[model samples]
Target: MSLRRLLRTDAAALIAAHRASVALHRSWVTPCLDQAGFEAWFSRTLAEDYLSLIALERGSGAVVGVFNASQISRGNFLSAYLGYYACVPYAGRGLMREALPQAIAYLFGEIGLHRIEANIQPGNAASIALARGAGFRLEGFSPRYLRIDGVWQDHERWALLADEAGF
Candidate 1:
């Protein structure tokens, strides 16, 4: 699979992929984020210059996953937060193992970001594993860090620094 920047033309495919991903993680993801919300969110990200990417099957052009990184500034820190999901069909295929490093490299090298973080639901083993595989170190846990599936959930924070990773 290859990763590419999300395009306006990819809206329909992204919606379909989003729905499939939601279904797969319905117990964790809020169902209220419907198609309209997805479109609007994507638009807002585009306007904010966030890097949103889609993983595509190289041969068939099928969208297999979506990933996003948004630059954030707080006090003296300038960093980015990472979010991603792989469609069920693409899970366990090592696609993220390939995509994430590229994304991180781009964030640090091209975007000039110093750090990237992943806030993963505590019980989401797949995501935690993915973050570790991508060389992010688990920092600590946050209680009631986010609302998932309409309920407050705890999250494990993980981070990677560009200098540390030598990227």
Candidate 2:
């Protein structure tokens, strides 16, 4: 798999992927499934504080998943929050497991971030395991942390620092 920054031209494929993965992503994420929504969401990724990337199959060029590093802070706190989801045809194929370390390296080395955090719903074992496998440690928990699918959900905070990443 290969990782690259998200492109505006990816709208059709991304929307199709998200639409197809609706069941797999139910209650986990709500990606834009149309052109207008994609336009609005994609606009934010153009900002300096957000680094949005897409994982692709090296040969077929199919989208495997998307990894976003948002709300990046500089100066004393060079950190960001992570948000991601695997697309249907590619979910559970160990593609993300292979791409995550590359994403971490991009965040720590290319983006020059000191820390990256991924907050996961307690029941989302898959997400939690992904973070853990990528060297993130359980930091703590937050009640009603983020509002998803119109409901506030609890989350476990997992984080990895640049030093811990050996960068």
Candidate 3:
């Protein structure tokens, strides 16, 4: 698989991937399923401290998933919050497990970020495992930390520092 910055031309493929993976991402994330939402999301990525990257299958160039790094703070903070989800055909293949660290390396090495954080819902085992396997430590928990699927959800905070990533 290959990972790269999301492009405007990828709208159709990305929306199709999101539409196909609705069941898999039900309780975890709600990616843009239409052109309007995709446009808004794409707009957000154009902001100063937010970025979105798309992962693709090498041969077919099919979108495997998307990773977003947002709320980046520079200066002494040097950190960002991460969000990601895998598409239907690619969900259980260990592909995200491989690509996440590469994304982190880019954030740390190329973007000069010192920390990256992932907030996961308590009941999502797959997401938790992905975060853990990527070297994120269990930092803490927050009640009603985020609203997902129209309800307030609790979350476990996980983080990885640049030094801890063994760059």
Candidate 4:
């Protein structure tokens, strides 16, 4: 697998991946997001200067996973937040393990960010594990950080510094 910047031509493939990811996340979150909302979100993401990478199957060009760093700032305290999801079939395949570091390098090295953080639902063990695998350190929990499945949910905060990320 290889990680690359998302291109305009990838819109449809990304849409498909978003649909799969949303469906999978629906079981765990509230006020599930719809395709229209996803489209708007994706469009806005693509327009950002922050990095957005996609894990593609080299041979088939299939987008198996998507990860992004948004809200980047380059002042003395440079920082950016991360978000990611993988297609159901790609889950547990260690694809994120490979893609995340690459994306981190771009964010911290090329993009000159000093810190990166991931916010995950408290019970989302899979995501928590992924953040740990990517060298993120658990920080603290936030109450009602996000609205999910129609209810406010608490989330755990995880962060990694540029040097600590080993990128």
Candidate 5:
């Protein structure tokens, strides 16, 4: 798998992929970016606070998933939150396990961030396992941490620091 930075030419494919993967992301209330939404949403100049990258199968050139690092803070708290979803065709294929280390490398080594956090719902064993496999440790729990699927949901905080990631 190869990581592709989101580009202007990917808008249509992203929309289609997102539509196909909607069911998988319903637990997170992820927005499906239509053309207009994509226009407003795909601004590339905000690297300081947000970053979006797509995982692609090298030979097939097919999109595997999208990984986002957002809410980045650079001051005393140098960290960001991760949000992601696997494309329908690539779900359960261990694409994340292959892609996350690369994402973590960019966040910690290139972005110069100290930590990357992923908040997961308790019942999402798959997601929790993904985080654990990527070397994120459970940090804490928050009640009503986020609004997912129109309801407040509890979440387990998971994080990986730069030093721990071999930065």
Candidate 6:
């Protein structure tokens, strides 16, 4: 597996995955970025306290997923929100299981963040399992915590601290 910062070169692959995974992600939050929107989003993303990356299969060069440390906050409360999705072909194959630990290490060790949180809809068992496998603890649940697909959806808050993330 390989991971790199998302670039214009990755736009097409990202869009394809986004489109293909619509059903899997429909109930999750997203901005539905097309190629142009992706370019625009990338142009503004880093400046807005977010870092996005693409994960690729080692030899095939096929994108396996996307990962992001979004809404970063520094100073005494160094932390960020974690977001990610595995491609249709790679989902349930433990690709995220491999990618997440690396991403978390990057956020905690390189980015110097003390905590990273992933809020997932309760019904997304796969996501919840992924978070748990990566050592995230279920902190609580929020009713209508976020508006996903125009509906206020509930989310279970999961988090891993720098010290506990097994980095």
Largest lDDT belongs to which candidate?
2
Per-residue C-alpha lDDT of model 4 across residues 23-120, encoded as one tens digit per residue: 67674532114556555655765654466678897788887787777787667879988887777678888887777787888888887888998999
Q: Which regions of candidate 5 deviate over 4 angstroms?
A: 44-47
> Which parts of model 1 are misplaced by more than 4 Å?
30-35, 74-76
Residue 53, candidate 6: C-alpha displacement in angstroms: 1.7
Each model's backbone clash number:
0, 0, 0, 6, 0, 0
Q: What are the Cα lDDT values of the candidates?
A: 0.77, 0.93, 0.92, 0.76, 0.84, 0.83
lDDT of 5 by residue, 1-167 (tens): 89867887888888998888888877764755598867665774255688888888888878888888889899999999987778888989898789888888888888899999999899888789889998999999999999876799999999999999889
Residue 135 lDDT (model 4):
88
Q: Which candidate is the best by TM-score?
A: 2
Query: Where is the poorest 10-residue window by lDDT in model 3?
Result: 96-105
Distance from true location, Cα of 132 in model 1, Å: 0.6
Which is superior by TM-score, 1 or 3?
Answer: 3
User: Sort by lDDT, best first: what order?
Assistant: 2, 3, 5, 6, 1, 4
On TM-score, who's better, 4 or 6? 6
Judged by lDDT against the true structure, how good is candidate 4? 0.76
| Cα misplacement distance, residue 166 of candidate 2 (Å) | 1.1
TM-score between model 5 and native: 0.92
Among all windows of ten consecutive residues in candidate 5, which has the lowest summed lDDT? Answer: 39-48
- Which residue pairs clash in candidate 2? none
- Relative to the unseen true structure, what is the C-alpha lDDT of residue 167 in candidate 2, on a scale of 0 to 100? 94
**TM-score of every prediction relative to native:** 0.88, 0.98, 0.97, 0.85, 0.92, 0.92
